[model samples]
Target: MLHNFAGNIEMYGILDAIASGPIEALTSENSTMVGVGMSMEGIEQNPIVYDLMSEMAFQHKKVDVKAWIELYIARRYGRSSPLIRDAWNILYHTVYNCTDEAYEKNRDVIVAFPDVNPSLISSPLEMYPHYGKPTSRRAILREKKNAYEQPHLWYSTSEVIKALELFIASGKELSASNTYGYDLVDLTRQSLAKYANELFLKIIDAYKFKDVDKVTSLSQKFLDLVEDMDTLLACHDGFLLGPWLESAKQLAQNEEEEKQFEWNARTQITMWFDNTEEEASLLRDYGNKYWSGLLRDYYGPRAAVYFKILIESVENGEDFRLHKWRREWIKLTNNWQSSRKLFQVKSSGNAVSISRSLYNKYLRSES
Candidate 1:
């Protein structure tokens, strides 16, 4: 049997749930086995969640959390230092320190569909359909306010920047460690992901004011950052979407089977299910990812379509056509989901170098 405590971020409470069992249910003749599992919703981008889970397992089995962290640092970098520990402590208190009421993981604006006026909608229909009366719109809007976690930053971005700085400072000592390299890239990725949300808000503001030049320029920078992020993630095998889809194909014996499996794999992460005119797949983008090829191809194109339409509307003196944009967006998403294009499965580039370059390019202080 599996126990699900994945929604809330209460680590200790989850551990307690894992450790506790039904009374009068255990005996020498019958044993109960429980497993702890994490959702893949954002796991690829948040490796620290795995680390947290491992810490939970160790704590549940009579190991101290502090000792586990120390050992983890040692094994992760083949050595530990005040710099590393200090950096990790900041991370523990900030990004890793989710409140009990917070979502399982933080969400990113990149995964959210672009809106001229951003508000979390209850149903896809309300956003796309104009036939609904004001009363019906009000009802639909209130329907799913808390259905799932919305995109939010629970911690300070400055603190995350400090953690990234510490990681970069320790690079000379841990450069040769693959685990350290992964952590470096992952930390940088996290830092920039948070910053991307800021950029997105700016984009929304520019769109709101109908600043054609500012919108055009900001959109380029946003897409460029997405491309750079994809490149950085492609440096690690764990961050590639290619191997994921390729593995699905490899499992098939025949070409027809391979095509089916590949389609299924793509669909699972993209639409979740087919969307219809009257109903939008509420689960669409629930599996939104930060994987390499996916960012460049899928998410990037979707945002590009949004910007293109927005800019055209401003130039042509037309109202932003929500339904038309949604139709175009769906077509773009479906084309990607159904395409047979294969992405590179193997990783390339140097993680440390890429991280440093990005730090200088995006995060370094000008003063």
Candidate 2:
């Protein structure tokens, strides 16, 4: 079975569930397996999550994450020790082990974009049907009260930052060995995203305070992280957009068919499932991926547009026109070839060692 069926971040344990089968059925000897479908991208994001699940299938055992991680660290890298286990402990209890009820708002950086103005109903990361359409003034007043509720408030901010550092250090420890390249790429991707999430919240705070200079500075930095993320993911063949697009192209017999197939591949990782134009937003960003081309080409431009509006609105002393922007965003979401910008097809630097030291630099209070 899978989690996040509604299409946001699922717990890292769904990997475990896939291997464990139903709790009642665990007593039976029947064969069970998981497809982990719609995962056309790289295996880099969460190898540990799935590796544990795979072992669960054969061992048919429950995970004492504490104990299992020791073995995991040893196997993935060439070594393991107290440092390794300590880091995994933090992840197991927090980000990896949360339930929907307990951590309702804990979301990725991109997913929390709507917090800037909860009334907007959609972030630049997505184009929700409710975003462009007009709503009553009563609804606006309601959102004003709740807009402060953001996903980043899920964990002890300092602790989460520490866990991200742990991942980066783990990447460094394993770099020279390079025992499992997939794990390296995945760790870097996670570190980059965690760092971005931290900055994302700061940007929102800056905007709240009308710190235009801070907004402009942090906005550029956040986009830089997104761009760097694309570079990191490019190390893996599965994370490259060229092959992803080509896979779609191979299924087409004509130019019209080609366009449709391309749209299918792109949407599968984005909006997901089949929906009409009016209902084009079901599960938006639910399956969001940071593939080579999608990050630099698709997500980057969207962020640029958002910060531009914020900076301009602040400069001119006028309110931001989110609806107008949403209309334009909707148009881009429909088109596959919004630009011809070239993106890195291969990763630069050692994805592991290069991202190694980021732990100290990013993990801290926002002071």
Choose the strongest candidate by TM-score.
1
Model 2, residue pairs in steric clash = 44-186
The per-residue C-alpha lDDT of model 2 at residue 318 equals: 72
Question: For each predicted model, how many residue pairs clash, with residues at least 3 apart or on different chains?
Answer: 0, 1
TM-score per prediction, in order, is 0.78, 0.70
RMSD over all Cα atoms, model 2: 7.7
* Alpha-carbon deviation at 10 in model 2, angstroms: 7.0
Give candidate 2's TM-score: 0.70
lDDT tens per residue, model 2, 1-367: 3333333332244333443453336565673644323332233345666576556545645556667777887877778755556766766665565333232322565533341442343232332113212223244334444433333222333454465566555654555655444555554565456557556656756775678999899999888777777766666664667766677768999988887787677776655544444344645565666567787777777777677887777777777767645655555566644223344545445565445434334433421
